[model samples]
Target: MRRYCLAAFLLLVLAAPAHAQAPAASLPKVAVFDFELFDTSLQGETDGPRTDEHDRLLRAGDQIRKGLAESGRYAIVDIAPVNAAAHEKNLQACGGCDVQLAQQLGADLAVTGVVQKVSNLILNMNIYMRNARTGHIVASMSADLRGNTDESWTRTASWLLRNRLLAPDFGRPQ
Candidate 1:
């Protein structure tokens, strides 16, 4: 009787859920959209060499897209190739900005972000995921890239990837 009871208890425990509430499944096929830059460059610094803000944002976006796709959590569809459609239509925000077009190309989700200057040497960014079918935002996150060091981009990529693999409510209340 004792052995049978112990076995039953163990079976029940093993079958129970680890968390009472968990998201159904991970969002797949995410596209990292363009990183919008809110320029805060000094106006009168003509003497100092100008950094191409647009190029930096594009590099960051590429880094994010590559990082997320490499994680195996998503099938990354490089929207850059199809960006001309958005430009022609002037569909900017990237969140429902091109859901119909994205669906046509067979992407399930899109990741978009913005890079803004909170202060000199401190850049703030918000990265988000959008569902292609419903055209709804599924997840969002923000991080600071400080001092333009190598670690800055690494941290940003890490945060973006973490949010993609793990459900939004995995670590906190939804």
Candidate 2:
């Protein structure tokens, strides 16, 4: 009878499920940089770069940061420090500068984008997400926009976030 009781206790212990661990308390941090503008519009007879276009690109960056933060999967790191560091390091257009900025800000991921305007009617918004530690691009998406207006740019960015960045399977190991 004693041996049977011991055997039953061992069997129950072996069949029981192991304890489940709690989820992480904090989300991963991401630093999103301003979307650079590469305007290729034909130089007018006497005109220069359009300041409005630059402003729109800057707004797009803010939109991206907000969108990612709202997703609840990541914590958006403040960009002011990253921008200051970039300026001090003269990191503009430098290779791996985005990653360097993210690392400095103690972020797990970094995002960078470019708005290429070929003309008033043709443009492209390209975004890249990289691992700050490895400096490897984890995701990339591009949207060919038809109009170079604020509404068109905003719409394109929203579509990219929905279809690529915030998709259900996004960030899963392939």
Candidate 3:
């Protein structure tokens, strides 16, 4: 009886699956493009372009990239290839440009942002995440900013990340 019981226990142990020791799956790679600036402050006016606002939008893009990378849910792919492809293809206005760029970088996902400013006191930031393979938007988030200072821009980016992108229930289909 002892021998039979021991044999049964050994058989069960050998047949059991070993899922606990399995390695964690790799995070998906995401390519984040620079935020495009559309400043309407001088609309219907003769004022020159606001280079300072343009530069600030560019900095916002970098902050977004850094935040996503630090989240550990995604691997941030470098944007050099994306920039090169955008310039070569004149994809600045193309709707699917971001998806194309992400595919070129071998990324699984793509992120694009837009900063639209009507004046120094009123602005909006929009961010979109898309599937590189299917070209479908997986998630979209935006924040309305009231101030024109550097602190306001940085805070908006962080708020978007915390409240939308990195949220526990983010990207779920309704």
Best by TM-score: 2
The predicted structure with the larger lDDT, 2 or 3, is 2
Task: Please identify model 1 stretches exceeding 4 Å from their true place.
Answer: 1-27, 40-51, 87-95, 148-151, 163-174
lDDT of 1 by residue, 2-41 (tens): 9999999999999898764333245366655666655465
Best-to-worst lDDT order? 2, 3, 1
Error of 3 at 167 (Å): 0.7
Residue-level lDDT for 71 in candidate 2 = 81
lDDT by residue (67-171, candidate 3, tens digit) is 877776677888885586654542346878778888989888888788778877899999888888888888999899997788888899889988998898675
Residue 98, candidate 3: alpha-carbon lDDT: 78
RMSD each, Å: 8.5, 9.7, 8.7
In terms of lDDT, the poorest run of 10 residues in model 2 is 17-26
- Backbone clashes (count) for model 3: 0
Candidate 2 per-residue lDDT over residues 137-165, each given as its tens digit: 88988999998888999999999988998
For each predicted model, how many residue pairs clash, with residues at least 3 apart or on different chains?
Answer: 0, 0, 0
